[model samples]
Target: MLRQLGSGAQYLATDINQHAAETTQATLEAHGVHADVIVTDIMSGLDKRLAGMVDVAVVNPPYVPTHVEEVGCRGIAASWAVGLNGRQVIDRILPAVREMLSERGWLYMVALEDNDPSDICHLMSEMGNLREMFQIDAADYMMSICGDDSLKELSSPGKSGSIFYLSQDERFVIKTLRKTELKILLKLLPKYYNHVRAYDNTLITNFFWRPQDYSERRKKGSLCCDEKYVLH
Candidate 1:
């Protein structure tokens, strides 16, 4: 899929197992695609060449919890033998990938529910310096308010009865609001915006947009308001 979507981009794939690397190379060749495939433990040895230069990365590491001894074993068992919380390989891969990512780089990783994906996200946020990544300036605020499609659904049906979404660049969070909440927010929006604009070091959440009605034209129910939150 990366080959299909990312035309003209340099592609590099790594596997600890030599056979797996060869298989990946064969698959690419069969499809008339060319990519560099290496037999190494997740981005090893290529760090010097690719560090802080990778634009996009996709990882499908071994995530099945098994005995520690099975982790580095040869053949098929090595594919799914993640030690303990299914994060042995995943934990190692995260930092390496972090270092390889450019400022605008994006990572797509496969994780099971048991692997605690949420915690992984938090870890990446900290490692990637989310304060800088999520910082919203005046121009960014205007663009987001003008109906940017970067806001993709993150999660839904939270304890607050709201749906949460994160921007594609992970710069902003969009949260659905209830009718009553929207009314209160609308009432204070002017004052809130003024205060935030006046004080650069304010601790208040930076709200980029007012409530946006997202109800379908044919829908008979109340309009759903999506509130955009920029963490600055």
Candidate 2:
């Protein structure tokens, strides 16, 4: 990360949004990160600008279904939030990503339960000298947002929030928390500022978890689900 690896030298941060890029640049400068930041739209011929030479990359792809604008939310750099039912986004850049690796680089991507089979496999297959070292179902990060007041209404009785339906964009829309989701959300979400328990899923399953199961996680690492603040 810029904080640890930056070491007062050079680094690069890219975001499609000019505003976000500039804002990140300012924040980096404030923190003394003398790095290059690219604000170009990565969606349009992005692989060309960044063909290869990457040693490592940490990315958190968005979770939302598509390009519809939320009332106040800004979108991620690329339309990287491939719909749960399709593999377009991954299809666009995955091959290029595989080719871009230094033969030692590994793409540490997250696999959401809703992710399509092809995407998940492609996300983990032996690529550029990288084999899956480990895998653990991470705490259900999507359901963690339920604790926020703004999201509480999605849990109200009879609300369609928790219901699973297909989005117009063909992604599975799991609105509310389920038992497994609650189990993880309650466990990992307290670190965020102002988080509190909201609705309990009430659904049950004969499930068990181990500490070592979660030890494999890299919270600060990239290539995980990037759906921060994107879920309704």
Candidate 3:
């Protein structure tokens, strides 16, 4: 990314990670490159007006949830980053990207397996952009910054340890997830988090009954069962 920026491309950079944004600014400034760095939460809603006008917007958005307060990130994590996870991030950003992009302008985004590169391309295609605009494809997630999260801690199996059998030992690290990435992972998340686990590790017994996103419901319909956080 730094190399691409240094090649004399007029690029705009943004991050939900404030520290990362600061680092980006410092790095760009050191190379004598001036990039527009905006420290705002996209989840709070994006500035479609400004975003839709840029020629090319480069982004490597967050792949994981961050709970701490970061440097340049003034607001909460972007909708895609934390709230609805990866799918929402792309859904929220793509529209504005379409608006900001010049008629023939291109958006260079690092596609992830979690979010499905094909889905990204499909969405872009649906937006009236030239089908293929030089996309560098990637498979498997780049675990460049895989830090431990309270995902396990934040999940629950309804009726204490009696119902939910969590295989994730709090002592565990992030295991290599599937190619489907966060999309598949989301399917494993216990609906209501912070509940106790079942005594048996055979299956996660707890379930959180909560509201579903309008879109998810529209596609999968109401889940006969909430996303099962089983002991996989």
Candidate 4:
């Protein structure tokens, strides 16, 4: 996404980690593209100049649930060490997004169940003049099948390297499980099924791999093939 935008626009990549910023620069260079990669906490220094000028804002923030004291840590840990409910950093980002976006701008953010996405959308909708124009659209079975906001949650599998996301209506969680973890999950399905049957309660619903052929998706927009499973 950044690569495509950088080709035709004034693309700037900012990160709190200096190493991350440098790495992004190197990646862009390797791709034969150019961008200003800066090390800054969010949009700290660039706010004033960029305010009301941004057309799109894309964020994949720190949405991992963690201890309150670990919210703003140093090094690579900072990438995922979000405070309680994973909302500390995400909550802060809303106001910054409002300040930086133009009247015609739109924000695309990725959030986990711990981040409370519905609440995030509601809060953003209520911000300034956005209430009339902004609405939440979730991509999930609940939204597609039930057409009502019925969602559920299961215990979080707190693994540092894993990435987790909830369906739009929060009916199911989608995790990027490692190969070994995927193997374990496949082995546990029968036990999980019997346990759920015994209790008559479950948040786990479906699991499958997303097709990685980007030919069709490329017609729609950029191709994002980062995940391997669609677990619910």
Model 4 has an lDDT value of 0.58
What are the runs in model 1 whose C-alpha is more than 4 Å off? Answer: 1-7, 130-232
Order by TM-score, highest first: 1, 4, 3, 2
> 1 or 2: which has the higher TM-score?
1
Best by TM-score: 1
lDDT, candidates in the order shown: 0.66, 0.39, 0.42, 0.58
What's the C-alpha lDDT at position 232 in model 2? 23
- TM-score, every prediction: 0.54, 0.40, 0.41, 0.53
Which whole-number lDDT from 0 to 100 does residue 212 have in model 1?
37
Error of 1 at 72 (Å): 3.0
Instruction: Identify the superior model by lDDT, candidate 1 or candidate 2.
Output: 1
Error at 58, model 1, angstroms: 0.8
Question: Against the true structure, whose lDDT is highest?
Answer: 1
* Candidate 2 TM-score, true structure as reference: 0.40
lDDT of 4 at 83: 72
Query: What tens digits encode model 3's per-residue C-alpha lDDT throughout 1-232?
Result: 5556565566567765688789889998997777777665442223323433466677666545334333224345442343323455555466446544665567787655766777666655543321121121111111211122222433332432212222233422222222244345344433212122223233543321111122332256532222322121
Candidates, ranked, lDDT: 1, 4, 3, 2
Model 1 RMSD, rounded to 1 decimal = 18.4
lDDT of 1 by residue, 47-123 (tens): 54675688999999999888878876878998899887797677667756776787789999999988989877766
